[model samples]
Target: MTPEERSLRARLAAHVSWAATPDPASRTAKARAAADSKFEREAREMHPDASDEHIARVAKHLRSAHFSRMALKAAARRRNSATPKAA
Candidate 1:
């Protein structure tokens, strides 16, 4: 019930609130769908006369490339984390 106790409780509550919130930048199905849609729109704009199949192929290629890069980065991070740090 002291002032210091109240301050500590407020800090803990703030930290918990932050930790409970999902990361805004984390990838999710919805985010991936949005990205796919954006890529398809861009492809359409670039090749207005292209067939739907071609546009879909282009979007698939773009999405695969994006995922490949993400995988590579994740692998690199895992390797780095596994390495022993110099004292």
Candidate 2:
């Protein structure tokens, strides 16, 4: 079994079911706050002379890249699932 599956099973056996699902507004707020915090923390390393707009653009590019990669993975999974399995 996968490690995640094992971990999930262990969590289940341990009777640990504590997942936090924030509201839309709360989620947006949390995401914005986290982005701001991260930008501030890594400002010097991200770019000693980078402006706020540059940082924002970089963040946007990263987000888009991640989303595109995930979409490609999902599409690949669907394509593989549709093909006939070899014996």
Candidate 3:
């Protein structure tokens, strides 16, 4: 291979290594997953009579568990409207 090709390959390898770093947020999700899974299992078990659509709706809310990005943005907009601008 040419020197230019070798240099490009090394840079790409380094970028891939950096990108693969484990994000801490993923670990937090992993910790929460056990509890969340148990909740889902129990919900299905206790409400075997409930419709799939209802279960899916409840599951969506459960999955969010907190303010999502869109919700945050909407909140920010509301706060902005309530605040006075500085001169």
Q: Please provide, for model 2 over 1-87, each residue's C-alpha lDDT reduced to its tens digit, 9 standing for 90 to 100.
A: 999999989988655433444455664798878866665556546676888777777666666676799999999999999999999
TM-score of 3: 0.34
Model 3 over residues 1-87: C-alpha lDDT tens digits? 999999999999978876786875674687778766765666677678888776666665756754476798899999999999999
Number of residue pairs clashing in candidate 1, backbone atoms closer than 3 angstroms, sequence gap of 3 or more or interchain: 0
Instruction: Please provide, for model 1 over 1-87, each residue's C-alpha lDDT reduced to its tens digit, 9 standing for 90 to 100.
Output: 999999999999988977886974563668877888998998898789999999999878877888999999999999999999999
The lDDT values for all models are 0.87, 0.73, 0.75
Compute each candidate's TM-score over C-alphas. Answer: 0.55, 0.54, 0.34
Residue 22 in candidate 2, Cα distance off native in Å: 10
The local lDDT score (0 to 100) that residue 66 gets in candidate 3 is 42
The best candidate by lDDT is: 1
Worst 10 residues of 1 by lDDT: 23-32
Summed over model 3, clashes come to: 0
lDDT (Cα, 0-100) at 28 in candidate 3: 68
RMSD to native, candidate 3: 12.1
Task: Name the regions of candidate 1 deviating beyond 4 angstroms.
Answer: 1-32, 45-48
- Cα lDDT of candidate 1 equals 0.87
Ranking by TM-score: 1, 2, 3
